[model samples]
Target: MTDRRLASVGTAAESRLPSRYLTPMDLVAMFRLPSVETVYQWRRKRTGPRAFRVGRHLRFDPVDVRAWVDAQRKEVAV
Candidate 1:
């Protein structure tokens, strides 16, 4: 598939994902960061990925998180 087509597919798939889920600590740990508190700060600043609450718990869709991380990876050309 062409790059454009692939990108379109990715965009569509991502759009179907939930925008909220992971708790501040979960997010930080998933990202392998140092402090969980930083996740909260990011939420307050609205600079990190979107998140939502489910009852008293927070969660992040594994697929969405993987997709987002993959998108951020640097591609190296041969």
Candidate 2:
């Protein structure tokens, strides 16, 4: 199969999404958070980037992550 077809095989909606999906640990490092628990807490409170489950793991879309950070910046400016 072509590389394009391989890419589409993973995510149903985001066919262009690369194979790398961010884990909660990635978010912790990105935000300099104390722990992965903070990421989970944000998920619980609905105050962070949108996430979805992959089997038993949580995954995030990079596009959504960037948009979320941008939204936060706009919020702070207001």
TM-score of each: 0.47, 0.74
lDDT of 2: 0.86
Off by over 4 Å in 2: 1-19
Taking the tens digit of each residue's C-alpha lDDT, what string does model 1 give over 1-78?
699999999888777545656566767766798897776676689656666668875555657566556655633221
> Number of clashes in every candidate structure?
5, 0
Give the per-residue lDDT of model 2 (tens digit) for 1-78: 698887776456454444487999988887899999999999999999999999999999888887798899999999
Location of the lowest summed lDDT over 10 successive residues in candidate 2: 10-19
Best by lDDT, which number?
A: 2
- Go through the candidates in order and give each one's C-alpha lDDT: 0.66, 0.86
Error of 2 at 15 (Å): 18
Clashing residue pairs found in predicted model 2: none
Best by TM-score: 2
